[model samples]
Target chain A: MSLPLIKRERIFAAVLIIPCILFITVFAFYPIGYSFYLSLHRIILSLPEIGQPFVGLENYRALLHDKVAMHSLINTFLFVFISTFFELLFGLVIALVINRQFKGRGFVRAAVLIPWAIPTVVSSQMWRFIFNDKYGLFNFILFGTDVSSYKAWLAEPVFAFLAIIITDVWKTSCFAALLILAGLQTIPDELYEAARIDGASAWQQFRKITLPLLKPALLVALLFRTMDAFRVFDLVFVMTQGGPADSTNVLQFYGYKKIFTEGLMGYGSTISVLVFLISFAVAMLYIRFIGTKLFKETA
Target chain B: MNRLAFYIVTTLVIFFSLLPFLWFVDTSLKTEIEVTAIPPVLLPSGTLHFYRSSIENYNLLHYVKNSIIVAGSVTVITISISIFTGYAVARLRLKYKGLIMGALLMVSMFPQISIAGPVWRILQSLGWLNSYQGLILPYVTLTLPLGVWIMASFFKELPSELEDSAKIDGCSHTQTLFKIMVPLAAPGVFTAAILVFIYAWNEFFFALLIMTQQEFQTLPVGIALFQGQYTLPWGEIAAASTVATIPLVLLVLLFQRRIVRGLSAGAIKG
Candidate 1:
């Protein structure tokens, strides 16, 4: 390519790229910066006549003392940790199954992806009904027409939380499986063949070879699933509404209620900032372990 | 693994994955009385009553129309912008390609709450709240990262010689992109479009905040905000959910391979 043509190409490329950058900056980057600025002031939408006032770190301080906020933070952390653990475990198992050559493999893969394909709000409603006291499949399965023996699952604090977690695990495990399955595809068949030739049992082969090779993909899945699990609003919003004594109140849902519902814009922005920072920290930690191989490949 | 064990595990995985949603589908088909039967009846009477009621009473078609408009617009816009972005990063000699790619990955990681309040305000100021464009703009922004990554990966795999030859034959970059590279990259474009559509169709948070008006809500938001008179409308909710999900179910069945490829393509590259 000639020098002037190369210049033309670069200009054309810039033209192609600028729109995306502008869109993202305006909608995503600017909003984040604006959110931070909003967090530093006291702006109550309901009490507009009071006027906006600089609160410095007043909202952050208030967040520390807010019992409901603290409780929600704890609940969010628990949901992230527990739901991620089960999703990965189930994901690994599903990945292993689908990776095998079997009859109806395509059907099985499609079937496994159905939950993931459905909207979260829809799934939440489905689970909510399942946990219903009177007309629930859960009660029918456990108590089996023993009408008086049925229990209200969502009415209790602990079970409501558990219900949300179960709903999440059901919906997302297949996504984790797909990522892990990609990792599985990259592993050489020779390694497994050699292990079997050396008289290694299936369990031994998985522990020694499969687990080691699957680490990078597992880390990728972990990073994404954890970030998503932290933002657990739709499930809590639909399934329980952070209810049964606020047992399912997650940080995202709590922040949502604070800002949109109660019009506590300043304090809600603070909560949003906290969620962002925590998710960022987790992503950074995972990226360190996964290494800059990701950056290198994309570049 | 033993054959019996393999079959058992497979059955259980499929059962667990499909049961909850299938239960909802079953519920959608039941008679209003059968829906609430204690020790809930496994076999539905297979009536379309709830579907009729949801559409008639809840204005389900209004929500569906809004979802199609929003998700369709987002996909078209995102895919168009991403094609340019992806091509630039993949084939062009950009000075800061790595930096741009990294920024996109960062954007993908951002929590929706972090941007929700300001985005709402931005739309409000522009007089776009409760409007289609308000929701579509953010949806496009959010889905762009995935679109760019998928398209870029696709573009990278194509032979540079093709573009080089086209250039040698006196073709400009724009002509080559449209006539040659795009048709060749049709699969990637299609994959990105599918994923983006699914995302926009399913997004709840921003839609909930931005489209608070009953007329503007998408299917997900509308189904979520469903209200009942005396008791919670389980039957109608189930019906609306089934109606909302059938297209996605059909999508999954038709394009399972492409959807799987797009998802993993976005992840493994990172």
Candidate 2:
């Protein structure tokens, strides 16, 4: 008896999904496929050349030996791993602190988001100035002796990388905290109450009950941050332009430079395709491990 | 003992979170002399010169207007398109539903920088370079995937019975979407709007690559240019940054819960 209605509703659902299908096909899937196509051929803009030669995976071969591409790939992974780790750690602490009953918790929670809300470019610029060697506040505060002798923060390799990481961590930790805090709020107070009744200490209860329950949210937060950190561009570009010696160059910036600055469109496309692959791999892993459970639960 | 330790840690964390901003405000209020004073002045000596001078010299208001215009338009367009498209995906049992959803999610993962070169060339040929449409359209495209995903989750949470009941009342699909689904999904809509607004407002690469003219520049680009031009004008830069940041700060503060919920909603669900 219900078969006919179920079938009809299924048909209706199909009808409803058509627009998104069309939109994604045209804008999303097409561009990705086109990018791969572009990567296989040599493209020259100056001489008005499009697909001059079918290079047949030669671009990928060249990218393997490309020093800048290799360096950027390593840096991208480093940035993602290090920043994501710290963001999760700091975010966990902040979430735990704010989740407790305390005076002005609301204000502190709100205040924390200020860094997250400020445009990355704006914050990068703000931090860039603070890192300035001459009359820069960071040098003034840290050294307390000579403001003029401060290192060019964006010039040196190590400092520049550290500076970008600091900016990223600052901007994104609040976001991680917000997500973890939401996860914390979902656990019933009775769980904690029950744990307390069994003589469980705060740390013990947190370790046993809270951590396990928060696994889904924690994984989701990690996945989001990992993907985002890998594709980092705006702050790095604005802060350093992959300078004072290409120290802060990540894969995305490297790809942009290849296409726009070098005009090697094919090579640039290859780099982008690699970035897409890396991110796609991460996304797939996340879905397989964490997203599957989330979807199953919701469905 | 526990309360004291908690307070101490909380205070330090808050201070660490806020020190950059405090330094920014402090720098903005100091004079050139004070800014470069041999021994730095942590506290301003009640000098309003730098702030006043920055306002008079730089068209901070104009940049603010341009940012508001770009961010506002992008948010409106992205949200509108996502509502219809997201509803379709979430509610409609369309063919290849999994494939469509997967494709959209994959697109969101693609780095914008990867396409910047080709996109730049395309926009140039179309004469969209230096135009608001040029910036807004790509920005919308960039934000749409996440927007759709978030909105879809919102729509999915909604029971289909309500839409069915509305349809049984002689309302067409479009009518049910507008009359029943949209109203029910208002919170999600607001959440999507806030996230899109933040992304568009903070977007730097497209603005930097496409909009070359200063007058047409968004706030981020304008600040970048300001940084490059005034190498030593930390005070002015800080003032401008503070000006640029105040609105977003206020928005986050005012809608703290909504923003948090929105972020968590997207992450936990999508």
Residue-wise C-alpha lDDT for candidate 2, range A1-299, written one tens digit per residue = 35665576666666655555555554455667767877898886555545468899999999899888898898899899999999999999888877788777778877888888888877887788778776667787778886546666778899899999998998899889889988888888999999899999999999999899898889989988998898788788778988767788999888877777777877788987888888888889988887455444223
TM-score for chain B of all predictions: 0.98, 0.92
lDDT of 2 by residue, B1-270 (tens): 777777876887788778888788888888788877655678887677876766667776777888899999999988988887788777775555566656666667767765666567667888989889888877887788768878888998999899888978878667888999999999899989988998899888888878888777888887777733634566777888888888888888888877777776646642
Off by over 4 Å in 2: A1-23, A49-51, A146-149, A294-299, B45-59, B157-164, B227-232
lDDT of 1 by residue, A130-169 (tens): 9899999999999998999899999899999999999999
- The alpha-carbon RMSD values of the candidates against the true structure, listed in the order shown, are 1.4, 3.2
Q: Give the TM-score of candidate 2.
A: 0.91
The most accurate candidate by lDDT is 1
Scored by TM-score, the top model is 1
Worst ten in a row by lDDT for model 1 chain B: B261-270
TM-score of each: 0.98, 0.91
